[model samples]
Target chain A: MESEKAKILPFYVLIDVSASMSGDKLDQANRIMPQVVDALAEAPILADKVRFCVIDFGSDAQVRLPLCDVLDQHSSLPSLTIRGATSYAAAFRLLRSEIEVNVKQLKADGYLVHRPAVFFISDGEPTDPEHEWRTAFQDLTAGFPTYPNFVPCGVDSANPRTLATLIHPASGPKQMQMYLMEKGQNPADAIAAIAEILISSMLASGQSMAQGSSGMILPAKQDLPAGISAHSSDDFV
Target chain B: MAAPEEGPVRPVPEGKWQGYVEPFVVGDPGRAAAGVVPLPDESAWDRKDTVLDAFALREGRARIVEVRAASVRGLAHRAYGKVRQDEYGFRRTANGRYLVVCVADGVSSGELSHKAAMIAAKGGARWLAGLLDRTEPADLPWGQFIRGVAVMIERNGRKLLRGRDDLDAEKCDVREVAQRLATTVLYAVIDLHAVDGTHAVHVVTVGDTSAWVLREGGRWEPQEAVKNDGAEVFSPTVHALPLPPATEPVPVRTTVRAGEALVLMTDGIGDPLGQGTGPVGRFLADVWERPPASGLEFAGQIGFARKSFDDDRTVVAVWPVNGR
Candidate 1:
């Protein structure tokens, strides 16, 4: 029974395509897309166990990349553009549909589907009112097997308060991590850090699954950046 | 039903309930002090809940519950600096049984500002718990409560800095550490009652920490002053105050009614009462006009504050459940 549960984790990258993200924000995201895909391809464990999806939200939300395994070399990741108002509600609705369909199909195939993780990067206030997104958010988050872990990364130009509201309801700010990527800091570096966090979390989840528990531990800060070497092994375990 | 036995069945006494509190501290692995002996988990005062005691009360009940959510990151220019300005706080008390919600921001100038902010939160909750033990649910004195909290913080601030080896030689006094570690604390205690009963909210703050009240009618009011015209400029280096004895405490208070939501936050949210339009202003308006869907929604609004502004921010909000 345990072996039948294929430990496949789906990661959804939700990018904000609002007009405010047009300049550096859009360029940085575009520059890092290929790197993110390449990194996943390089990690054999992640390649086998993880799937990727992309949802771009502007005046409307569109799924640029559907759920596909990294090992499938035929899959081509698409470039995202910035152009519309930030309609968070539309993006969330589309994501809910994607998750439900994929999760259902995976389950029927006897594959274990971990609650999908969402990395929502946004830089503006929602164009819609609070009520516009409430019911949809509650329903979507509730549908997950476990509470969905939504990490909303805020750009310096964006509104942090609005980003906070977009995360899953159960998580506190302490659990919501943030990093600032300046104008010249390699976009690939930031993407690498994010990839490291996600991959490391997936590996940790795998270990805990094998041990018959659901505990997960994040990698130390040094281990997260590709070039930075871990100085003190005892610092974090 | 069988006729009651002649002898009264001894009522099962309520079980003795003991509460436990612990504080866990994880220093940034990237910046561990060399040769410094790391304190044992049990020995380190970080994890112990210094304020967990129960008191006897009459059968008729009233209680207050609160929860806080916060997150912060070091500024881009200073991410690797010795002082990493990150926000930290928790929902120290939950609404279901008893709640205590507090959010504090340590002045960045203080070398140990983060530690001070954490200690203030933990200490403030303990102090509030102690106050609740003595006062009745409805009769909670807003003024006295604020004063009591001020005194407790002042005292705790003194204790936290006493005999610290980290003190600077050029500035040898507790006030230096106290002022550097000076944090603005904002907290709310909600008294819960049955459907027909009234609930009260008591809020307190010093410096620029802000509190907002949202009503069932969808109107929101600033519970505390948002802008600090005379706000003290925090200095990383401790300097002697020329104005008055540094021991005086500053206190403010306000009351909240039933079906109202209260939000407490640090300056990291920007001056909610400040001039012109800002994200904090918009957020204050949103919370005032609409009922947050959940605690996460409240937190998300606070997170939105970080995008447009650059400061370590924290917010604690409370929504009392209406009785049926």
Candidate 2:
């Protein structure tokens, strides 16, 4: 064993694969997923610190990519297809359990793991009852020491107000943010921009860890891509 | 573990180009590539400033203690073309009975935090030495002295940017500038002329800079509270100096028994070394069992790279010679 433990930052790219996202939105996401993986894989320092995962949720949620060091492998990202209705409760419940297991495994492997960050991209409202999803979201976030930074990007018919509720801690320091596509913006363009934001945030966060001052470094509001407006969880509150 | 690896491991041929050990990475070797250029800031004018520095001295009455200290700009800072934000300073009291060493890590967020680190390390050590010279240990007011140090940092830090265009000096809050120029600092005062073989070290820390006693057989016994070892997650937040004048820092007094060394360092070393049982701790404990051949070698040890731990690393170590 290399006895020397590596500091690792785990990032999950959670995407919605509901029937409404069947066309250009889903195609654009599939195309950009590889690019995101490749970009992180190319940077050795960033890759060493970042463990990337992809989870897709429709009526159910499935782990498209297991969390792994980006530097270790180069494989095609599992394609996300149209599934059933958007179930935020299912996504939240799966994420809650996966993160716990993944974080524990990383620690056992002799790595110092920082809080996981989830980049959730959704294109529709949750079909599940507000109570069911809200309960799951609360369990996934509130009072959880290893709760991930929940960044939800709303596109097309996705509700900006509904997405804002997903922000973990929901207040204070505002590590997690919600981004919405402008009313007239193209969904494909919005998906591509979210990809860009995800990459930018990961690179920035990894760079901070490399500097020995570690934390989740979110993109500043001004840095967000055009057509994507960043909102504060405080605004929703 | 087998006796700690012996003196100064030579740099691998591939990494020798950089002089320091090319840090070891778990994945692709190229992950050590250069970082984004840091945008021009207030400290940009001094970009060519020294990135690596060291200090050493041997002093005592009945027992001699060798002191070696070094500071290096972390790879992340180097990648961004930023200057090293960590600093270390030392002073021998006027009476020559005590040695004061201070190490500081400038909070990376502040534009001129490196300057703050310099002031705290150099000025804090100098100020403490001056106070030690005039005041008896029994009468020295520890709490008031630390609180005053915070005030002094605020005054000196403001003075540093006196002529800068951005500052409205008259209206600026003292605590605000202190917060902007925040840095974590650790001070270790050694009783050099101790009658007993054990040299007593009085340590005061603001923020995360820490100290430990490296006992015989390479044990890193932490001098302060160790909170992260068994915790579920690591809290990155730290309390830094230039704190409110009302906050009086506590001090940890420990004795370095014969054959033991006292080590004071910034989180650069502490975070990775964690309880000192892992690779970093084991590597350091073995190599540092005794003093290195020279200050340069000791500096090399301080800069050892492990993946994900790139930060400005600074350490001051004191070892009391038993028979000298």
- Per-candidate local distance difference test: 0.51, 0.76
What are the runs in model 1 whose C-alpha is more than 4 Å off? Answer: A1-237, B1-68, B74-98, B136-171, B194-198, B216-218, B229-259, B270-279, B284-297, B305-308
CAPRI grade, predicted model 2: acceptable
> What DockQ results do all the predictions give, each relative to the true complex?
0.02, 0.40
lDDT of 1 by residue, B249-280 (tens): 33334445446656666655543224213333
Could you give candidate 2's per-residue lDDT for residues B1-324 as a string of tens digits? 111225456576873554344443323233553432333334566643234433343453343666777887776676656677888899989888888889898887766678778888888889889989987554567777666667767777788767777776546886568556778888888887666777777888877889999989988899987535555765566677677533666778889965788999988788777777776777888878877766667777787756666677889888777644
Looking at candidate 1 chain B, the ten consecutive residues that score lowest on lDDT are: B24-33
- Residue-level error in angstroms, candidate 1, position A11: 44
Model 2: per-residue Cα lDDT over A178-221, one tens digit each? 88898999998999989988888888887676544566777888
TM-scores of the candidates, chain A only = 0.76, 0.94
Kept native contacts, as fractions per model, are 0.00, 0.40
Interface RMSD of 2: 3.7
